[model samples]
Target: MTDIPEELALATLACRAGQYQTSELEQSEALFLSSSFCFESAAQAAARFSGDEEGNVYSRFTNPTVRGFEQRLAAMEGGERAIGTSSGMSAILSLVMATLVSGDEIVASRSVFGTTVNLFKNVLSKFGIVTTLVDMTNLDAWERAMTSRTRMLFLETPSNPLTDVADLQALADLAHQHGAQLVVDNCFCTPVLQRPLEFGADVVVHSATKYLDGQGRCLGGALVGSSALMEERLVPFLRSAGPTMSPFNAWVFLKGLETLQIRMERHSRSATVVARWLDEHPAVRRVYYPGLESHPQYALARAQQSDFGGIVSFDVADRAAAWRIVDNLRLFSITANLGDAKSIVTHPATTTHGRLSAEDRESMNVGEGLLRLSVGLEDPNDLLCDIEQAIG
Candidate 1:
């Protein structure tokens, strides 16, 4: 294992961190495909299994390729350690299960991904964990939601589909005041734009399935935090539960990290262009993007993030109009997934947030007309032309 300097820029760290070389000295990171590692002797095997030694025992908890990805992401996010998971939802599950017991509670932003709402409301509720959803930007709402049992404050800034930005510092301060940990999902911004840990977040979670994988080629997730939280809490749960990322996916994500920063910058630029175009269009009743001056949290976004992110959402008149636009698009794929090399357009009311009750959807302001666009690396002009033709 070669140590990457702390002083190296994020782009350099992305490329060089957590690199391990074999006896062959290959420049690229090697893939260890074996399920379990071999030990030199019975004593060594016993030691490894008993944690008296630090080496791979099983791929479920210890694999070189996955460890490398974890190390690299931890360094990028300024976290002491990271734990990899099979998918984004699994990461959140592992974090909640590891940190909170029955009778504990979470205060979360209403603007999170639809599945996250279901996870907290439907799944965790069955385990005796309570969740309260509040407006992302309303500090008063967040403060009022906390209680003696509130163990965590969870939110996604520039939130899913809506693009509503939260004040990280304020939320962190509030959580700490109540002796609770602040957990921020960094899926949309990645480390290239906003690092939640730097703003006093105790934990930063990533759907590495999103921008971290860059090309949408793999399903993965990670939790980045202090060594104590990761090793003491999350690791045991992961080892027991076996929601483990495969070595192949980890290798794919490693390559993705090398180009992540550059791709995010391009995505931000293109998204900004599309957002501006939508803001001026008569067909678009409203646009949701932190980069736009019209955005409620534009100033806060400018202060906290290096750039506005790649997602841009807008509303027309109704679901029918939104569907017409989506159906006519030549370039954008109509999919629920986001953060791909190819542009994606989703009607959130019918797809991402469809499962929520109408009242719940209304609270999140995910209207029937809402169209969420995951702007890609395509030429901004080409995307604009596509939108124009679709609208026509």
Candidate 2:
């Protein structure tokens, strides 16, 4: 078999990838909102339902707009198939619900999104699944934590709020050795900064609401992998469970994908400035950007990701100081979400990560003083002033 060209420059792919046109010669992608397609006869409808005719049967399973987004995302991720979901968490849930069994186990990094930890520990536990969370940076711990029942390894590199860099290539190798799959949450870094599949990961998940949309305008998620995994495993679950991505949301996400490369570069540049400035600030105790030299896995981050990413996390003196900074930010959105074209600031201890138990929070080192800053397309100087005045 000939090797596929996964190394095509993303800029080139962004321009030319996933464009399926008809004799209608429409300039922009069209949205298909109808519930069902018009078949020539009952026999043809039956063929579509039975997979004999490769056409859409229902909007829930097959829609042109959703399929367009999937194709575009799959091309960007260098994968054969992509499945979009209603939300980021649903993408993960569908993956587990489709792939893993009741007795199966997962060895995952504790530094993933708080909701993700909850899903695996609390939600999946109800169905007889077991999850063991470990320090993402600890390779030895991951090796020791694996069991015969282990079927998957999950993680979020440059993880939420704290920017902990997990070694994707290493973990992928380890998972394969244990007869398991590695599922990397490509939410923070995105395809613009990192491609886990190139590093040996079996599947890549995305919270398209964040960096992929490059704006907080849509809520969508995606799973990209081999055709076998998607068509056989995850797609069937989505067809029934109906964790479906809307055609409108998918169209919005596609537009976001157009500018992803440039947006991510700009966000990285501004965030580096913010993270560096925060590290030197008087009230700021630490900045948790992977770009920082002081970061624990700085070199690993440099190697694994194309850019340091848009998120700049920091620690103030205490919870009061953190709140002061957040409360005073004039230009940034004070929401739990990140990866927007507009700047966003959040205190994970009280917002995103607050859902985790105290022990869980402590284990992940999500401190009371922690602040997550998602630097957008704003001028870096203005952002610096916004945070500095907030500190004062």
Candidate 3:
């Protein structure tokens, strides 16, 4: 029941913010597993339903556990409000649904997660919403792609598989100039590493299923922004459409937040070592890690992010070579999910970006030989040996 002081560090906020302890005064956050709450009387129930009082009416939109997670995340991200959702994809869908109308346009980064590209192109297009994809690093490309109908500029910095970094401040300025909201997916970096809102972004979206859970346990998502926009647009859409995160998942995410700062620091340090090793390896045709000096956006990443994050991707000769290394890895788990305690190795040409057209993949430089590594808390020396033998 204590307020998070403005002077508290991020580590303090992650561990203690948004905790509303009951009279029992539990030290850790309590897991409220109930579906709904009972009112003290009929008038109280009526008042809650009529929005005259603030109280839990249903789990879908008013679960205490979910709200605690929302409050904690909003505080961490420096946003005034946040709305929790069932999954990361749903978070994006909710953002679009809440803000854009029929025939509204979105200018998005071509180097985004493959599924996100599909969602904007395939799913939202059916509803008359259109998306234009352009190179993420090209400020001029983003300017050219914008139209009068553009309602949003969406992108993921240090993007999936490629580790492509975007100039968020420039993009934010461009979006506002075009009367569009900039929505940055902070999944890869989390708030511990990079905060999009500090750079003038209008909104920040998250796949809490990733680093927020930090162990591949639960699926959830969130949208964070000013209180006015959140209460006016996002909350009502989520309440009615029901893409809401479960109370249990919210609790799990809350636990994940507690250890987020330390975990990210470790992930970044290990990934830097791994990236350097891969860059030196003869078989690795190219390395894509923001921490590496060879990375084209290294300066930009250092400027914008506190850490470079855990993902380290590289190129081989072909798909066969990429699969060989992935199949040979003994220490790394071969899976699509990133931001886990166990390191993951995936052939992006066959898994994450497999659905995109060959031309699309080529444009994004997702080569046939590309392999994505989600470096975890493992010993860096062991990871290097595993990858070295795998490459051989």
The whole-model lDDT of each prediction reads 0.94, 0.89, 0.92
Write candidate 3's Cα lDDT for 61-170 as tens digits: 78888989999999899899999999999999999999999999999999999999999999999999999999999999999998899999999999988999999999
Per-residue CA lDDT of candidate 2, range 27-144, in tens?
6777777877889999998899999889888889888888888988888988888999999999999999999999999999999999999999999999999999999899999999
Which candidate model has the greater lDDT, 1 or 3? 1
Q: For residues 1-392, write the lDDT of model 1, one tens digit per residue.
A: 78756878999989999998899998999999989999999999999999999999999979999999999999899899999999999999999999999999999999999999999999999999999999989999999999999999999998998999999999999999999999999999999999999999999999999999988789999999999999999999999999989999999999999999999999999999999999989989999999998899999999999999899999999999999999999889987778999999999999989999999999999999999999999999999999999988
Residue 259 Cα positional deviation in candidate 3, in Å, after optimal superposition: 0.6
Report RMSD for candidate 2.
Answer: 2.3
Candidate 1: deviation at residue 292, Å? 0.7
Clashing pairs in 3: none
Worst 10 residues of 2 by lDDT: 1-10
- For candidate 1, the 10 contiguous residues with the lowest summed lDDT are 1-10
